[model samples]
Target: MTDTLIKVDLSQSAYDNDMIHNRWHPDIPMVAWVRPGDDFIVECVDWTGGQIKNDDDASDVRDVDLSQVHFLSGPIGVKGAEPGDLLVVDFLDIGAFSDSLWGFNGFFSKKNGGGFLTEHFPEAQKSIWDIKGMFTSSRHIPGVNFAGLIHPGLIGCLPSKEMLNTWNTREAELYNTDPDRVPALATLPYGPTAHMGRMQGDAAKSAAAEGARTVPPREHGGNCDIKDLSRGAKVFFPVYVDGGGLSMGDLHFSQGDGEITFCGAIEMAGWIHLKVSLIKGGMAKYGVKNPIFKPSPITPTYNDYLIFEGISVDEGGKQHYLDVHIAYRQACLNAIEYLKKFGYSGAQAYAILGTAPVQGHISGVVDIPNACATLWLPTEIFEFSIQPGADGPTIFDTKGIDVPLAKDL
Candidate 1:
């Protein structure tokens, strides 16, 4: 039989709900599983279900009940998918409703209150801004890639009853804060120092009042907005509940790393096509929780590590370069150690890793005190083996030192 493509109609009232607060109910029809080579397309509704039109403005955005903004479709069942299996969602394509561009002051703008720059530009605010016309040309370049790419910012299945409630409460508290104070308050580090203590207390009280919604990351994945979860990317999610309780929202058009705005790209309408497959008998082994990871295979090599500094630039153009270089170096070191656990010799690991290690800058500066950098080894380096013990670790062996190739899930 030809693989079937499931069409989920978001236009139905049963699927309509507030984007921010709704969770995928198991009752929604789910897409079934197919073999590795099977293919299909799934239709999705705009985050607003077309209720908010193309011409809607800042007033429309402001008046939106925070809960009902980002509606998504599906919890499509993958037939034969059990609790321990992994749902491999291959994103084949994504298309937006139309080419019309739109932009508004984001959650970080002064008026909306709360961003890394709030302290520096205490008065910088925009009530009704248009980002459609802004464009820049490079000195050596001849053209501009119209900035737009849609992907969800928050996508994952709910963890547990308590965790979902906590996430909801936190979001509510964040929404109720004075737009001005929100930015600063949200960025404050949790601690016992006077300022941190006070902020934590207030946040705690706010969360409690808002019904204690929380989202914690664990073996059962919660809110991980890894930007790579886009078209052409394959995400392997472990099933927790019987139907997996899959849900996705927080649409972004284009966003830099670190999603400094705590928001991403354009929040608009689009549909994502996914194919679900079962990874039989794969569960959290080695105490590993959250059975999700980018499936890009990396080869081992030894070479000088590339490094980049992550810095936040203020509206006044001030630059805050945190010790990003140190962070980058440490991350590389950590990778080496992690590989050692897999049983590869230090020299072999370093040599294989050095083949191509690129340093990446995560936009931590966009939000104060949330700095991050990444070191990555290219997936092309690993040579895949066929016979199990012929040469290298088994594909399933993500542990051990001195080798490469992640086991196919």
Candidate 2:
């Protein structure tokens, strides 16, 4: 048996675990040490750190704290890793603990953590997916089942104080531009909710006050949320400090290209089988400042897809110039509208797009006036035929089955 280097007690609060931390600060002590070529197992609580529940009623989702998230499993130090080297990681395998065979996906209320399509669907809602080996399905969403592409949604190394200052300064600049916007432009460091692993006293307090929130993907790759970076993938992460303090959590059983739902993906408590190595001076060798990766060779092939297109026009019929965000949002909205004709409520259709292996593409950007984006919905994931036919469409008989919702307070 491979040694379980850092084991988490999921039954306890993630904050109570010394092995877990929510903020990124170089001063936080490494919990474990390993050498290059070492392979081990590390367990993690779900991203919300056990706040979201297995039950229906998205009240938990609605009230969930956005700040206290992405509780990561390690600052596991690699013996020889240093700044400007690449800490190479191979995700040999990833699986849910037998005790946790389920996961939750939810849309956040716009007032809280708004999603990509927060305007169209602006309240907190949730769907629970039950995992059965390689496959998953939801009682909250009937007539849909698919194999998951499991992966860690967040992973990265500790930033040197200089790098950390750059992140805070740049993000704060964006936040100040529209500081009061709902969900804010960017999440800044907050001392109250930070979990600085083993750090204590004024040191922990100061670091927490400036530590970067694990919300957006940064230069050090904090939370990229890419679905393709799954089990079997090999990633080369840029080391920013000595020992290359690497930490990761936010395991997702399945998710689309963009986790369109804010409380997104089939979020679960899981473990990763990882092998770490070093690429000496590989940062400059590869011209890499951002993390680079080779995706998993093994993945589910949902070949047949019904593709939907959207331009940069907003829902209000206002035209935007080459905006990929607006274009993707329109594509998602179009898919939801089409699915509604097949008897799925908009929320169910939206949740399906979030948890399934859907694809979003930026097809055109140089075209004048509008950028074209496409949403590819896999037909195989659905039990019934979803293709357009002369018979128009078959209503899927959803039978009042819908994801749980908690109206925004």
Candidate 3:
């Protein structure tokens, strides 16, 4: 662990890098090996594998293929690791590469990958944020700057073949229910675009056709996107295969809870300094079904917030019974409307909720006909005072400051 165990060439396509892969399968070979107690570095490309750029154009965000996403670094094998063991990972530190101090935040198109609130925002859009040491800001969205809560948006161990099959079967069943639905119910394996690290020819082909898409968080913890799992946090991951083929990427400089925008967060190309250990038979002992973690010891503190509440009622006034999803969406929409009162555009306000250290909570679910949800917008993130007053809201001169957009073709 004296040097970087895995390094990525940012200029190279992730599909061309033997150390990177987009699918998860036990057969995908580990690019490196490490024993318990080892500490090392692993570099990663942005989630879209550099598909999005620093420029203002959102066409790349609009045209990017969702199938070739989330290019991750490593299934780094750990010696003596076995199934049912817990792979204890300590995130010692994380940082954006000095050479690439910028990242992206965007909303995918409804026809492409519609997000949590896609119906309200049906088109593709993007905003680029420049990282300055521990803080980040975007020229596209004016009047705000804050410290980042950096973390890896996706990280986990490879699943056993049985678990992989279970994922495909269940997801396929759901997908089959609405095969032609926009944004898809589930992402199935696509062999042609799959990157089975270090595998070639027939073996690669066989694994690719069955490999699980790294789109959702499964039992082994792929793409959970928890903003609290940042540097200084520790995770206990369930190992389903020997060597605990651990892989991680999709780094973010900052992300609000829910990552409402599917192409959400201040996505970045960065490095993680981690230390690993094992707790043999700990999974069963702890009755763990999925990954668990301790919050980062060092994280951004934004206590002052403006909280917005929403019920299970839809935007069109259609009432639904105990639907947290719809409630949360309403809460997010409520916050965006509040931001607009201060002169921020709808898109810019939406982007802020996606990238800033905002908080969302399922406030109440047993309230009879309606579920209650709350969205907490950190007042401290804004330069101007956002607290409500007797004089109503103070509108800022936002004129031209706005998030970039790319209309669907």
Candidate 4:
């Protein structure tokens, strides 16, 4: 039988909200029926959902309402999707409809009160630029290549009532106990005062107000805009509710590593065409429970441990750099301990791992953690092999011997 797929248009009329959530309305009917392994195309409206016509200024950013800003398309139910299956979403293609502009005022930017840069620059300038030619103009510093990467900013499932209420009530109590905590919770545009008061009444009762949906996950799915999850990469997500209730939003054109500022290289909207498939009993097939699972192997063949040492040197005549020296020593010790976990002799591991492992250095300026190091393991040394009957081996159980073969090793 031929593969069945569906086509959705975010610009269509079937969606409920006209604001953020409506940009990629989920109410539209399927273009066609679909099953596992089917490929489909989806046409998306820009984040504005066609509300802000051309000639809109960057200040238009303020016009977006928080409640309706992040409109997503659909919870496209996957056929035969059970609570125990795995959904393998391959990002086949992503492109923008037109040139767009995303400035430093949105949720992802640090200009906001709760952002990472808030303390660094209490009063900072708002940066804005034209994204019309972003695809061609935007480039990684010192690198000649134009940027190209795609990741979803929002993707998740409907949560149960218990989970929803627990979060709401917790927030309310926290706010009431300490009003200063309000700034910490300002990541989004929700009405802070109203939320705090509502939470105070009855945390559990307030949970009944609205079901929770779209929580971020680090387990391997949903709003994990990891730069590595790009074209040609395979991602595995565990199925929770029936059909997995899958949806995708916050399509980013490109982003940097760590997503430090939380903003991507470019935030724009367009059509994202992809293929979806299922591995029947895939979750159990791979020993994963949650829909999100890490792609790395627990006991990798080659590994590197990283440590960062931040040193502050006082330029006064005394010449003190104690903090820097301590940080460096701590990093070295961390690396040694990390290598020992993989069956390396202290001296050998330090010598070999230090030379072979990938290293990264960064400068930490005023009011920020600085001077960091990263250890990278080459994928070639250790290959991911699935064992049908075992949870895999532990480094301690191995008694300090490296497993040579991926399977028996």
Candidate 5:
């Protein structure tokens, strides 16, 4: 087993400095050839590509170049892969970048996509975590610590050139109509200047022009930051092109469900132990095109104490559309109001909310007029007082909950 494991390094090639770090052009040569049954151990770099160092501070965090994010590991060619096959990747285990365990979490510039709460906390701020053993400690927010969940924030294959073209055309149209829906060039990984990491040569230029921006979660699974995909998680990706062109990076020590404020989740570099295999004709069998996954066991130590509820609803039903953002924000506002009873101001509440072990969930989206989102928070972190339970608000938890599918299903 040891001899069968291939190692994929995360450094520049002799010819192209930005080969594996900044760009994601399918034309870039594959670093290694992984067979269907091959086991591999990948050495991945910090998502920032040497931009943010371990010893860096919050000021340094603010200075980070947005273009250099998501420094990934491979375009590792799977020996027997073809389009439409399911590339099943099993995450065996994950570890810290090296012996020195440290990571950073900060809010990105508003010029970028601007995290969910970007307007709430405009100035960039960060917490440097001293991650060791199984827990993470932060000096920025003292007296709170929690066990970490190690997982690749990004794990998937490249989309076909046709699909890429469709995405670009659609997004360009969206940009022309509503630019806010698309991230700014500062935040777009595919933007021209974004082919960063010592941009040189023609392939680099083409990649810079055509690389898929690693921001949204697409069918190709670029930056799907699902938190529960810790060690032992098995993921299935739809292969859109030959060899599957698989890549992985953006490792997170831990993250909540929403990854709410986005510039996110205990960002760190680590070793990824993966087993690659394939399910022939799986796309037709499952009738799905995006990545599918089975998460490992969840943290049993913490129990959800508060569940904030929100709906894409208002006094007038005009605003009650299918926009999840409306529901998500309402749920977040519920959490903010809940935090206010504990003596936190609105902005401070949103900032701390982003870092806290809180999760957001769309309980159901199929509702006719009102879609609902729930914000779950753990009571374990609060030492002083939490409203309603710790002598605070008169929040009646009962008579307010609705069972949507309970009645029909």
Candidate 6:
């Protein structure tokens, strides 16, 4: 297999810069056909396109056209790929829009899909990061800078007809049951956000009511925002359509574990060099139904840290009743209290934890009535000294909050 570098041009429109497809539908025409072993450099527009511009400020966060959230670059078809097979996308290199790239992390808002702690914090916030080589620093939130590992936050193939129907049906049912939760499936844009003419793209004149949204991660892998898909990573997707109508977009300069707060980990416009190959009958072998990828450099050197642990417990005397969300919230609360020691207000700390280089892990879910979650905060990013909390009791110690333990039960 010889390396033939191909460039998929996405920098085309006046607004989008590159001609990119904001929608993903099986009926969408293939932008290009690459033979197996052909390497390509896909130019990805920033997740926002023109909805939010370089000159824009945090106030602009509210005006962002929510409908056009993820602007995907292509439905690049692989010549011989087919459904049920595993399409292997080899990420050779991922970086800035070109030599220079800047990104933003839009804070949680009530109008858009709510944040991890939406009820508590409803106001919007935006932080801009200047990307230089491997480093990222923001002036808004002074004192922290970290190496940026670039990767496509959203990448996947077109879903089969059956799969698409399943997606729509399940989504409809979910919305039908709870109108409030409907926002999860689709958040109406704050203003006029979508430029791609309605009923005109891949979903145009097709069986689908509209293009399948590029929000949720599906069998056809749309916004799976998992970090570590940097250089030398193998992303495998379960092909659902002929030629494995592959698409990629929503490149993130860097991201934390849950991307729990904002539109997600420092959203940016960039290019990812990909080389795709096929794994015939890989579905049967792996018994996996969706996209799965082996991230390179499996373990990362996450420098420094404060660890906050939380276990899910309910009111009264309860043990084996576990709520993962409660456990996660507990971890967040612990981290927030810890951040207070460093001079950050609770709300400030909440947004920072959501946007910063923090990592959250499910330490233990099998521990009977208590599922544990741990949040790891990297110390190196702080401009100030990393210090332990005071000798007295901490928030977790006196808590009747997010954490799951029933102390005086």
Better of 2 and 4 by lDDT: 2
Q: Distance from true position, residue 192, model 1, in Å? A: 34
Candidate 5 global CA lDDT score: 0.68
Candidate 5 residue pairs in clash (backbone atoms < 3 Å): none
Clashing pairs in 2: none
lDDT of 6 at 278: 92
Q: What is the lDDT of candidate 2?
A: 0.93
lDDT of each: 0.40, 0.93, 0.93, 0.41, 0.68, 0.68
lDDT of 6 by residue, 1-409 (tens): 5332324333454233333566566666676789889887777667776455454355567656566667776678898898878999998877775544788776646666657766655656666778877778765555567776677888898887677667777777776676766236443222234433223544454533445667778877788887878888898899889999787877787777788775658888777788889988888889978778888673346667888887785323355466787788778877877776655556556656755667888888786778898888887776666657466423222122211111111
Q: What's each prediction's clash count? A: 48, 0, 0, 10, 0, 9
Residues 272-391 of candidate 2: C-alpha lDDT, one tens digit per residue:
999999999999999998999899987889889999999999989999999998999989999999999999999999999999999989999999899999999999999999999998
Against the hidden reference, what TM-scores do the models get?
A: 0.50, 0.99, 0.99, 0.54, 0.83, 0.84
Candidate 4 backbone collisions, by pair: 20-68, 20-69, 20-71, 21-71, 26-73, 165-207, 219-292, 238-291, 311-324, 364-370
For model 3, the superposed segments whose C-alpha errors exceed 4 Å read: none
Better of 3 and 5 by TM-score: 3
Candidate 6 wrongly placed segments (more than 4 Å)? 1-19, 181-208, 298-300, 313-320, 389-409
What is the per-residue lDDT of model 4 for residues 165-198, given as tens digits with 9 covering 90 to 100? 5545665565566656523442222422111111
Better of 3 and 4 by TM-score: 3
Residue 39 in candidate 2, Cα distance off native in Å: 0.4
* Cα lDDT of model 3 by residue, 1-409, tens digit: 3679889889989988999999999999989999999999999999989899899899998999888987999989999899999999999999999899999999999999989989889999999999998889899998899899899999999999999999999999999999999879999989988989899999999999999999999999999999998888999999999999999999999999999998889999999999999999989999999999998977688888899999999999999999999999999999999889999999999999999998889999998899999998989989898788999899988897678889999
Q: Which parts of model 4 have CA positions greater than 4 angstroms off?
A: 1-33, 46-58, 98-113, 121-134, 138-145, 160-182, 186-208, 213-215, 218-220, 284-409
On residues 1-409, what C-alpha lDDT tens digit does candidate 1 reach at each position?
A: 4332434344454233222223332233343434444565544454444443334232343233333333444444455656666766676655543443442223233444333333432332211112243221111111112223345555554344454354555655765585354433332212221111111245533432332111223344434545456666667777755656555654444444343322223444445665556676566442334646653232123243323332333334454455454454445455545554444434333322222223245435345543565655433223432222445544324343221211211
